[model samples]
Target: MNLYPFRCSLALMAMVGAVISCSKQTTDPMEMTSLPGDTVLNVNYESGTLSSGVTGISSTHASAVDANYMVQPGAKGSYAIAHKVVYGDTAYYSDGAYRSESDAVALPAARFAPGDERRYEFSVLLKDWTPWLSGAIHETNIFQLKVSGNSTTGSGVPLQVRVARNALRLRYADNIRVYNFLADVRPYINQWIHFRIDAKWTLDATGYIRTYMKLPGHSFTIVDEKTNYATFAGNPAVGNIGYIKWGIYGIQEGLTRIAYHDDIRIIRLN
Candidate 1:
């Protein structure tokens, strides 16, 4: 005879349970604090420009709007940096390679000095990609950890994240030593692929670089890592410093490539 009050109690209990479920889904601790640290650079491209600790933008022959590189809506938040490269657009050159990149450079002062341990996290989306299924497009670098000042003289870049053979490749070359890692990425096209690089910039054998990757709706997995290896080239005493540059580089083939980058954070580990 008083079932109305009982029904009201049931409704209230349902609401409380729903609220708790929503709270648990929304406030995921792992998602929020997956990589917490002293952030030296945090850029989401939400400002529609290069923000945070970005020193400058380097693009080859970027005359028109969003030519080689521009901040646009795509990767993360409301905007991300778009890097584009077409065939025969190779006026700019660096490290003895023809480049068509819209690279974001982290100048010398913002670079990781010797004995620095840092975590570099970023997300990349391939809006349009010409796979390396055929032709002279053997490989293309999407990111680089370059050596500056007196450090090594070979590639001038110790670490490189590249796209090759329809796969994601990680290459490490310091002086005469070289290492490689590969993961097939054909099924992951047009989807966001997140990467994290924890590295110790050292000239000695005490340095290491561990790379992790995360797919959508999945946890991060360690794709590759190098230990007891040198992470930098040359000598710091001669003015060697290591810096990061991300964009599309080494597109020798006659195909158009477009990629988006966002949510880049460089955390000082030590």
Candidate 2:
């Protein structure tokens, strides 16, 4: 008998509930915060330029070498650095994009001592893998941490992350270490992968370098952990400063390799 009035009351209640629900929705943006601890270099490459103030020098060539290296759109953001090393490219065997600083960040002889730890994190995507030949060596340095000496000799650690003919390889000093983390990584081509290096620079038996890698849809797995690694010679007179250079280096003859990188971070953990 009073069904009309009951329906009207129900509609009014529904309208009030709608208004309350709408009011609860927030239009304000979320705030962003930096990660805890000290950061020496944090480059996301969103600026579309290699000169992001993390280092004083960004280069495609160390000594008149020429390769295609530029900041383009990337996986994690709107910008990423792409490096292309083609066979017969002019300049030294060293070719690709790199940012360098002298004794800055965690590379100083004073900053990274025995028991001091530093973390280097970055993401890499292998856009194109160089073709492989039977029994041939296809080694390229994708990331490098070099300890520069006085104009005569240069020594440091280099990550041969891309070895086209076989699995990934890492070259530190005269030693070559291979990893199956990306064994037959051809299937993961064009997919972003994560790489990390936690280094404790020292001359004695206490020194170590722990390497971690994360494939898509997977957590970071330790690829290698080496103790007494020759990351740096104890003699400060040889070189007290170090620098980081990432991008395709040591391009093999007759092969063209391309890769993209983003979110490079260097942190000092005291």
- TM per prediction: 0.75, 0.71
Model 1, 1-270: lDDT tens digits are: 879999999999999999998777645422333345478677677767644335564544444344444455646678777777665654444455545454445344447866898878888887757566666536778887777653234326777888877778776674243334545676777888888888888877899888888887888778777888777765666665677777777775567777778887777777
Distance (Å) between predicted and true CA of 261, model 1? 0.7
Top-lDDT structure, candidate number:
1
For model 2, residues 197-251, the per-residue Cα lDDT tens digits are: 8787765667677778878998777887777655554345555555566677655
Each candidate structure's count of clashing pairs: 3, 1
